[model samples]
Target chain A: MLSPEGREQIKYKARKFIFGSKDTEGVGKLAAVYLLLISIGFVYLYPVLYMISKSFMNLNDLLDTSINWIPSQMYLENYKQAFQSMDYWKTFRDSVVIAGIPTLINVVICAIVGYGFARYDFKGKKLCIGLLLFSFILPPQATMMPTYVFYTDIGLINSIKAFIVPAILGQGLKSQIFILIFFNFFRQIPKVLIEAAKIDGAGHFKIFRRIALPSAAPAILVVFLFSIVWYWNESYLTQLYVVGAFTSNAGGYHWSSLIVSLKNFENSYNTARSVAGSGMVDINESIEMAGTMLSILPLLIMYLVLQKQFVESVDRTGITGE
Target chain B: MKNGRKTKPGQLERRENAIGYLFILPWLIGILVLVLWPMVQSFGYSLNKIRLLPQGMAKLYVGFENYSQIFLKDPDFIMGLESYLLETLIAVPVIVAFSLIIAMLLNQKISCRGIFRMIFFLPIIIASGPVMQQLADQEAASIPMMNVTMIEQLLDEYLPHVLAVSITSVFSNMITLLWYSGVQILIFLAALQKIDTSLYEAAKMDGGSKWECFWKITLPTVKPMILLNVVYTVIFMSNNEQNALIVLIYDTMLSATGGYGYASAMAWLYSVIESAIVIFFAVLIMGRKDVYERRARKYQRELKREKRLEKKIRKRGERNERNYAKQKAKQQRKGANKKSA
Candidate 1:
């Protein structure tokens, strides 16, 4: 029943589809993949997008059922309140001190210990390595009480010494994993290079300093970033150790202060509701969202700037035992 | 002289040992003072009744009474343990498999791969304790798709009892579960990239399809990584602050009437269960015959055989040269004697 021109066109299209001429199949596949990626990317980014959008909405816009993605107006007051409540500048300084000092100490100590484990053979080395891994496997909660008691006994509680002392000794936040990373990196250094250095009269310290350390730069950076992030995000220990030391009025803040502030806001709202004989809380949702956003803003910026290196670090660290 | 040479290297070895110990001295001290001592103390604390006082601490030896209370008396403790174990058992495999799939997808040559990776990994960087808590408080961590009551109603009407409940619960918290997979995906991606492309090409040339290549080459190549991911996921999930067991321990510790001994006992019990789970997964996943190891052994054997054959050929050639030299020497001596005559 087809016309001659229509039959010719159908035959030509069939041939193109079967042979995949003109790279049509490739383009179609690429389009399909892009579609899949974007959809999943949207899912992964939904919470953060929600945070940002909700943080920018005013009370009326936030409560508006139709407004979802963007706000009617850009509200800056929420940021102002979050900043004031968090004592932004002072807390930022304290966070840097708390997360930074330990990171530096931890990296150096872990690198030295890892170098020893990797490059040298000594009595009980196997046992030491076993203990290192065992410590990592054991949950910190298991030892939390005793460590607390010990720190109190030594009068190191409520102070940064609690973090620094352990870091100096290479037992800081996930230091075992850092040591293992360094161990893997040091082990990958070419034996021939070390042999050549030895023949050139380089001693153990000199070889480690001038050869192994230089070659392990990528691993060092990776561990440094991981250590910093871990220490920065560590709230459980901070809450347990330093909560009593700082009051809201004192302007001293842990990274966990955001949670405390939210809790306080809820408590104050409940009290107000009871006093007013109403079910409403005065604090708006946008302000709370703004506080949450502010809390993670520094980390988000850090990740954005160092994302390439962070991703590359995972590939280079051999943490997955590649 | 032989003894002297041997003693010199022995001395050098001792020196090296000294240097190694020196390098690890800080870690050694840390292990002794921070890790080992606290672990011992934790064990001791679990067996006693500890009371904090205004003046000093009072400790009464309870002799496993605390442990008995947890098992024989406290329903909450047992329930927490059961739920924690069940969640871990279900979540570990699901998270691992999900991350593996995501990693495979990301590993493909595609446009905007970096942006995709960044989006997936961004949650891990920013989902610190406070941030995650805040998000959960705001109900932002829930999946709207899963929250549709119609699907739940259908599941309840059609599926069996346990399957229906488990599926519903998993879907309800799907967002949090997905968030947990960021680090696992990165690890798996690294493992995926380590696989050689030539193997895939060879498989293709042998007329193997993509599915066969994936099963025969890619899966086997990343098997060890799968085990690693399983272990990592187990430990990471179990140790998080949101875990039921950890929350229980914190609550018990903070309660006015709850004793430190009881909390310590709970913590120890949790640790034991965690170790058991880790060991179970490790044994189950790692007990298979490793294809890479078999290939490596075969390659080593072939190399040894080739080396032995080469050595034999060189030995025969050297013997032939010696024989020729002796014959030439005899001929030259005879010629010299003839000239003398």
Candidate 2:
């Protein structure tokens, strides 16, 4: 029963709704976003996908260009070789201890120092903060030699104590950044809250313990996560200090991480190859990819489990401040 | 709370300060001993001949000999340093821009956003040195479809060899660069999220297109973040385990001929170069004030300078008047004395 003009107006409104107007997004834009995300996401995960696909391909499948992504069949032999070569169990345990202990120490000490900086009227506070930033800026290379000598002299070489001591003293890997994160968070706590606590006869330490620490969960989580990841991946410092690579008696106690072991995987794999009596295929791209996949398998699982926390962390933590 | 009248405010402040110092004492000690002292000792080591013996170590001062030897005798070091500088310079911008773009894209209202974020951030977890080394070795770092050789040939014709090589290397390292952008993406996204939605709405009300709104509104608000991300990117690239110079330094430290002294020199030199890159980028970003901001600042300076100049002129006039008045008084006093005589 509608007139011709009314029908045309209705059609125009529907078209506008579909194609977008000034206020809301249209289907076209959404499609574009999805397309871009998928393509980039594919590219972003290309190496990982390639690693997985290649790891599952045996010698024949790897050699055949026709077997690009899908293998002719699933293969497990590459993983077996990589696992044996990496000493997966021992290094995994050591990696946990190495990355875990320092993270705990870094979290606690950084929080204390950061809280002090945030909630104090101390003299030379600016100088202290400046020095903290300066240390963050100065590359570790500038201080590597002397610190190495000091660690060797103290008999901390080739042991976990090398990392633990510095961490206990609040000089862990990227400790300055963690301290800054805590400082930024702690600065936001209202002074009135602390004053009220003081009025209730709570001493400074009591107030910090009962009040300040509980409110800094986000900062602590961030510091803990980043510290562990950095420490786990730190082959350079770990090699120099913990493994005693250059010392007269090296590899005495045999402390190492998975990534560190993986760093020298070729040599280890070659040794293991000789011991295996040459039945294995020559070390090729597939095996190397398999070894990498093995090395990252645990981390990938962790990422899967903690993906939500890791993604939302920056948003919820306010780590990026004005 | 009970006996506050007896204690001076100074005493309370002193106690508070003492507690603060106690809290920070651990860090202070660590920085002094582990950081500052070693920095000094490392500098000293860089200027000496360090010998490893059965009983202990020996050192003889060689001054700038180690540095000169590195610069003059070692072509590889110079080439490595040059390439490091070029790569870092080119890579930082590309990484920053790429992250900023992705952050904006993610900032848009999209479904299944969490999955995309996880994919982008996946690199932070598994990009250990060995893993990256293996991937790069397998030629998996570059996309197989990129046709890098074609790009290389295309670039080689128009650019110098050094630039062409670095550009090609940058292009080839595109994926690892993407990996480096994860933290930066988070940073940019955080910065982008912080932009007040009303600003965009107002721009829309003024008939501003999305592009205009972005350039006029979004860019200025996140400008500080650009500098921050640049510095962060520079630092990350320099400290990354994949950096050839760091590996070289590590190797030099362990080698028989290179030893501690020569290695320290290399480390120091490398650090200086790294710092220079950071500073260069920092200055580039920080020095570029917005046009409006620049004008406003210049206007403010002019006002301040005008006030200061007026004060200077007035002070000079007051001084001249006082001197003239003093001279007239002296002349009058001399004439009065003469008349009295």
Candidate 3:
């Protein structure tokens, strides 16, 4: 019924169709897998990407669009300006002083208390442990005003003393108890090690230092890292106490924070820096964006570098595990 | 109950007591000086209307007036409580459902599971501390997408409250909740993996469909985790102070008025409510038992027989359909040949 040319054409078409099926199916699966991964990854990474983008833009540019992930031209000067704006050196110095002293105190006090909780049987052991958990749950806000009043009553307000005293006592009243880490890590050490040291005539202090403290180094490290981050990021309390005190001392301007400072900057910069009737400040956006970038840089850098330990602690201990 | 009987302490035990007290002295001293006395004073302050100077001067103690003002008079406190309830109501179920599905997906034998886990955990890192500000900004920007035309068209007519709820606090909080789902996922992952593979193998051997196996085997095994996730998500949602105390406290602090005392009262009240909610649901879930039954002998036999019948019917139906189609085609070919002849 068919000529040789027609028959050959039909066979050729059939062979071509059959060969394409395998490659097409493989490519289809790969595409779907790629699409799925990319979408989920994008959603997860979007915020960090946004932070990086905003950090580079000038303040005005930040508000000009919904988002500017890629700036047409990068302005490297925002970083320079943020350093100057925050009085970066002074803030950094003050931050280190405030955060460091408390952390040292927290480590020492928490290590001892945690050891007591872990190793010894005392009269109020159950009650004391219960109270510690109670303190943990007590929202810091509930206590902040009283704590403030208490500090003022004792002449501890507006100084590094204000931050350090609570921290030193393991009573900072933040959600975290540095002692929890002490409790966990201490509990893990073979009780016999401490018992053996005690029986050999090492007193409590000697045993805690020579045996328990060294055994709990990882927890100590974890707590130190957490405490430093806590003290550094404590902008609210710092703002509440420090901002009012410093502004009042200056006598004229009631300087608000950058959260509030942004509005002032816009008004001042627009009026002074704008070239006749341009109606917008030349670099206002740049400054604001740069300010936000600068304020958060120390935190971001520290987080990026130490996220491994930070996450490791949470993964291992479940945070609330006794 | 037995406190009346006083036992004599041995010398070694007394010595241990003295050593223990000495070791914990710094914390005791700190708590006395810093936490306790101030907390007591604040409770008194909550009862009074105070003027705050940099110095410790309390002008007057008006009994329970500050507490009354927050509980009886302040509309914002009430509104804040309602908003918190609304957020918890909307966000908790979504988080439970979303996380369980995600845990299931992660449990699949897929490449790059670690990457998915890390991505899921990224939000948690953002949830705490200074990193919150950037996360907050991104959350704000993502707000408008909740009002997408297609989503609106589908759900708007049916669930009008969804729009209002989703746009404001609910959407951002859901995003925050999504990050926190990592912990739940990890917990669920542990639960899922612990599930006896033999149960699944037995189901497969009996020719159970994937859907049936999931409902009959997987759901029952992970029931406890599902309950845990729900309770944790609810607690986390309530503890977000934005819906509770942040705005009130911040405004008061900035204004430098007597708002701190009232805010403290509100915080105290809200925490009580939150703890009550968590405890209530926790008790409810742990007491329930319908979810825990293993397969009965009769049920197992019935399931196996049904699955075999389904398989047999499917094979026969496919063969019959193919044979009928081939017969129809052959008849068409014969008709064409008759026409040609």
Name the best candidate (by DockQ). Answer: 2
Judging by TM-score against the true structure, name the best candidate. 2
lDDT of 3 by residue, A70-178 (tens): 7656867766655454556655666666667777887777888888777777778787777776565555565677776566668666566666677667775242356
Distance from true position, residue A293, model 1, in Å? 0.4
Tens digits of per-residue lDDT, candidate 2, B58-130, equal: 9999999999999899887898888888998899999999999999999898888988999999998988788
Candidate 2 local lDDT, residue A99: 90
* A65-93 per-residue lDDT for model 2 (tens digits): 78789988888999888888888899889
- Candidate 1 lDDT, tens digit per residue, A1-322? 9999999999888777654443244555567767877877777787888889988988889778999878998888777766665656766777777788899998889999999999888889999999997888888878888888888889667667788899999999999989999998898888899999999999889999999998888988988888888877777776676543332324433343433344354453445456656434356778778877876777789999999987778899877664
CAPRI-style class, candidate 3? incorrect
Between candidates 1 and 3, the lDDT winner: 1
Instruction: Return whichever of 1 and 3 wins on TM-score.
Output: 1
DockQ of 2: 0.65
Ranking by TM-score: 2, 1, 3
Model 3 clash tally, residue pairs:
7
State the lDDT of candidate 1 residue by residue for B1-341, as single tens digits.
Answer: 55534556587777777788988999999999888888789889999988888886689998999999999999998988877787888888888998988898899887688989889898778766667776777777877555556667888898876556666666666777888888889888998998888888787778887678777898888888888788788888887766777878987876766667889899899888898998999898777655666788899999999999999999999998999998899889999989997
The per-candidate TM-score of the B chain, in the order shown, comes to 0.80, 0.85, 0.65
lDDT of 3 at B192: 71
